[model samples]
Target: MRNKIITVCTAAVMLVMTASCGADKNMKKGEKFLAIGEYYEAAIQFKKAYGKTPPKERDKRGQRAAKLARCYDRMNSHQKAIAAYRNVIRYKQDTPETHAALARLLLKNGNYKEAAREFQTVLDTLKGNRLAENGLESALTAQRKKEEGSRYIVRKMDVFNSRRADFSPMFYGDEYDRLYFTSTRNEAEGDELSGITGTKNGDIFYSEKDDKGKWGKPQTIESGLNTEFDEGACCFTPDQREMYLTQCTSDPAYPRYATIVTSNRTDAAWSKATKLDITRDTLSSYAHPAISPDGEWLYFTSDMPGGKGGLDIWRVRITGAGLGGVENLGEPVNTAGDEMFPTFRPNGDLYFSSNGHPGMGGLDIFIASPDKKTGKFVLEHPGYPLNSQGDDFGMTFEGPHNRGFFSSNRGDGRGWDHIYSFEKPEIIQTVKGWVYEMEGYELPAAQVYMVGNDGTNLKLSVKGDGSFTQVVNPGTDYIMLATCKGFLNHKEEISIRQTDESEEHVLQFPLASIRVPVLIDNIFYDFDKYTLKPESATALDELVKLLEENPNVTIELSAHCDYRGSEAYNKKLSQKRAETVVEYLIAHGIAKDRLTPVGYGKEKPKTIRKKLTEAYPWLKEGDVLTEDFIKQLDKDKQEMCNQLNRRTEFIVLRTTYGMFDEKGNLKNPPKPAKEENKHDEDEIFDIFIE
Candidate 1:
């Protein structure tokens, strides 16, 4: 099957002449050029031969068309190859190989339906055809893989692409500020064009970032590093003192086979490269070198003797200045189909492109993570748009981040590989909380004890504003306790939410102050009755927890009423309501002696707070809601003041309860239990206006 290269070309429609001599001569010349890998010249000869042959000679015309198509395929002229293959089929000269090549080209051009048919046609006869089977799977996967696309933001690196194929991006040096890649640009050393890509043979080129962080124009590496032959697909040692790369030397007498070579870095320039004696098998190709992060293994692609499949990833141990025996990575990393372009993230993840695995299309990239139990790599496909229905390979990461550049021919009609930058933004999650007195302002001196299910135990201090923000991991459960001197701890439990965007979770830590009475908001009761409403359970339960958090503290539950009611009636109602709250607290595990109920009636008025002024701009902070003060306001404002006055609250009586006895000796803790009490006062109560 044809590899990734030329696709589209301008059509040359010429009427075939009933010529004999010129057609035969041109066809033979085309065959010679095609055999020697002069695809550009081969295509020229075949096209002329196809045109000169008589139209009635369909077989001869088809042969020439198929030959031209093969050249176009190798040159990355995808569209032209597709058109030429159709001609070969229309003329009744199509073979299984021809159909397989057409299937690949059609798939790259997004004609999956037609490509599938072609693949099936070839696979029906050639049951062991790996290319056809892989192509069929790619066709189906390409249609369904998009919904599972990753969060990676991929963009073409236009500065790195050229008219010809430019691929295999590699980061250079410790700083990762320089980028090296293989390009077949016209400026490359070779005067002759590559029959493979219809451009000059590939050369190593590099670009460095300027002070402004923009990559400067790419420049060819000096002389000894590059030669007339194809030199690219390179990797550097951790120290960058040694370079390993692929080099393909051309010889018309035989087929060109790629071999790995090494070059030493002398000063700022690379010394002349020498072929690595990897194995005795001269018929095989060795290319695409990658150095492990630890610099202990040299991973490269080879069709060597012991490979599991076509072009499997193999590794040779780096022993000082020499290499050890090679080992195939083996299944499922190496499939029956071609697997190439193996690279690594700084974090030991092996990334390679393969058509053997179920993929979107062409060479879709896969990540091989080291399985903890077996230490063997387990494959994972990072779904679209990091991969697509075209040849996608050559991944290079910038350090440990989930971001970097890779090469792909996706969306390019010519099937030329171009560099693309991709990044999956980090899921930044943080928990922001404010620790403050329940009835007062922020507790700036408060300390928060934080614990998480993910082994995170930390003591965080609040800022001057009593707010603490800490970075948290996603999908992890966490609990925080905000504590300060003279204050009962406030416990908050949360989980970092699962979402696509970075998230900030807000928590409120309203610590119960041991000195002042803290208003218990959200406490509700039946209108005109002291009977507690069902909704009052939540507030009462929280109070129970607060008392439990400070086991040594005793509290007095005080209830008050607005001045609209009679003094005696209000007092009786407030007293009954306070008694109800105490009962609820006692039922929820607080000691009966630790809680005392009191009724202040209309004698105690509420004070306006800064928060109240926000909703009612007419009111000011620190304004006492006495009967006289509430009456002068608007009807809504007056009710709001009264609503604030009719409240239930608690004040800490002593922090030594159940801790020290009359003898001043520390006593054992007391077990909390409920006790029965009778209160037959009137059932009058206030609304839960707040």
Candidate 2:
């Protein structure tokens, strides 16, 4: 009986010791976990410590509460973090950092009035605090925007989402029938739980539409692409022949390193993955692959050195040549916080997510406008429904329009991202172009090439009626060029704007035939001299650009003189003038061999081309500007004839200049004359005089 009493007393003593050490021991453990960035485990220990501390122990209780608040914030539990921070303030242990942090959390939780009050409290204590000032302004602005409401219609993509994370939706295929996305659902191919999210590893899944136009259940993609490790944030090449994705390989000792991998698509199956050789640095992470709309640039998020901060958006050339060096998108796009998930609209406007820039809270989606003059990106929040206090990112558009799917953790307290569809109905801008002959008929075989200031370049094939249509984005400037085998190029400038309210724009290209002498207007030399005048430079510069575009053609740039000078003197002067034009072409990077200077002094007089003849049928072929002819015409007609006679023109010497093979034969033989276009003698004529 005495031994049993002693044992009971010992047990009671041990229990008392454990209780006495409870709060301090848990606090120490929490500190260790937080130091290692294991926030989920740290939060649990911190909460336990905070619960055990008594209300009278103000210093210890405040310490535990502050730590717990920080842990919750790190774990993405902003609401809980806010409550714990308030507890810290109640216990009189709030510091400037704590007040600022609480204010940010309030802003993120959409408590604008409370957030502004908290920021003001900090500002009152800590004078000249830029962060507090900015926080106050941001909170007030966000409140006003929230009151204004949003124009976007946002809806949860229920059919494609799961209880787990589902994000980064990519639309593919010619008909946009297939939808590919990354998910962490239980059925994902991986059996191992992720150390980061405590769920199954990410895998690529795709959904297809049936005859009813409803998306079917998503199926795991092929094994070659989806693996046991984290694989996600995929993008396809312009031709859909290749795919690039982010693959994070895990390590037990070190942090997981996210690397980009490429897989070729062939025979309706993907090949084994190969790591994209971006850089030799293995310590940094690269993820969230985004191929530019043109497919020439591969943009991704990276934490590599030489960045502005934590994770900056970077790009590299991924054309046929090897991958180029990574370039960081600096400044406003990147701050001391993370900037990630970069995607582009067809118009080259960049959409990305950032926590650094001021917004509602967490990661907010922003549209970055490219400033051509500064070579920097100016940022603007997408606002409200599209951007919330939660982590909103990984946006993909349904082609070039405004309706698209994006991933967000908004409204879900657990920080699990899910896909949402957003649409803003507006008039779709389009460009319809016509490439027809300047005078006679439409050139069915002509092709139109469009180049835009937004980095859009495409070759548009014309229909049987020499018409082509292309969808264009608003606020873009485009130069469209039309070209045919036997015709000189024609160019038209087009500008599309949103504020104009005009839905459609029409552009016309009037192509001129190359078989006849094509006049180069506005080209005039100084009186009795071969030197080109300043006014003539614009026309000559255009000729230089034309030569650069049509590299396969050799041309004779000939100058003609009026019948005022002697034949010998006129010939020499004209030859010098032609040589001067040729010299300008060569100075502007045109090949010297492609140009031939000729002088047709008084030998080749003006003959009305089809355009001129149609406007003035009285001017006939083989007409010359002799003294007798000058006396027979009226004053205006005589001046017109003289002006036409003194001109410069380009004659196509050979169409096969650079098109010949090693054996001096045309690589592409010319089509039959009838197949090209029927030449009518009544319509086609040559004018020359001596």
Q: What lDDT score is found at residue 347 in candidate 1? A: 61
Clashes of 2: 0
Per-model TM-score versus the true fold: 0.59, 0.62
Per-residue alpha-carbon lDDT of candidate 2 for residues 114-170, written as tens digits (9 for 90 to 100): 999998999999987766786787787886665666788899989999999999988
Show the lowest summed lDDT stretch of 10 residues, model 2: 681-690
- Model 2 off-target regions past 4 Å? 1-13, 19-71, 87-95, 121-132, 372-375, 431-448, 451-470, 473-690
Tens-digit lDDT string for candidate 1 (418-468): 999999887656788999877568887787877778866666656556876
Spell out the clash pairs found in candidate 2: none
lDDT of 1 at 86: 96
What is the C-alpha local distance difference test score of candidate 2? 0.79
- Total colliding residue pairs, candidate 1: 13
